[model samples]
Target: MSEFGNLVDSIEIPLRWGDQDAYGHANNTVYFRFFEEARITWLDSVPMKTAPKGTGPIIIKTSATFLKELNYPATVQVRTYAGKAGNTSLESWYEIFDSKTGVKYAEGYAKIVWFDHETRKSTRLPDELRALAAE
Candidate 1:
């Protein structure tokens, strides 16, 4: 798998037949879902009550690079790494690999900002969540 930094979490996602496109490879958009799953899994590790009532992490930007085509009847392991953290935003990186063969399929990163649902503005990340991201 491509290394971005120290891995913080990982999850196995099974490929569904519906994930494939007319071209017979996994749809490009599916990679983003895999990354989302990994990111959510990592974030869920933090205490739910850490954030203020109306504040939570929201994706501000995301990007991915496909290295290989993913086919059906396979399983992928998505690994997440913690990146730089700021007062109101944090970075998360992802590496997707074939679970059995260990071949990397894609790599990506996302910038997530802490947001206040009520105010619709950026907010500071909770101390607990920030500590987890720093790890």
Candidate 2:
């Protein structure tokens, strides 16, 4: 198994009934939202001089793997870590695990490309972002 950085950030989300499928387990698509929360948590951890210039990395790809079932009446913890921060893109990994068991219920990764909003084109990640991710 690839050992990633320690728990960089986390978000607790309440389980909604609608989050479950007919089988009474959390729907597969809902895992993406959990991943989103983790990403936002990581972004929140990194203090910014400005609001990312509203033109930095943008989500380009995402994938999820389900390991176990999660149901309503349960609170989930989305743990986050930086997997690979590249020159033109970065990858973030997430684990939605039971807060008590620490057992991962689901996991996923997202790849994002840095973009120049003004030009509407992709660009290499800024040095400051690279440094922040290094930590």
Instruction: Report backbone clashes per prediction.
Output: 0, 0
TM-score of each: 0.91, 0.85
**What lDDT does the true structure give each of the candidates?**
0.87, 0.77
Q: What is the C-alpha RMSD, rounded to one decimal, of candidate 2?
A: 2.5
Residue 39 accuracy (lDDT) in model 1: 90
> How do the residues 15-111 of candidate 1 rate in per-residue lDDT, one tens digit apiece?
9999999999999999999999899988888666754457888998999999999999899999998777798988889999999999999999999
- Candidate maximizing lDDT: 1
Instruction: TM-score for candidate 1, please give it.
Output: 0.91
Candidate 2, residues 33-90, lDDT tens digits: the string is 8888778767767765553556666899999889989978788888887766787877
Span of ten consecutive residues with least summed lDDT in model 2: 1-10
Q: Output the lDDT of residue 133, model 1.
A: 65
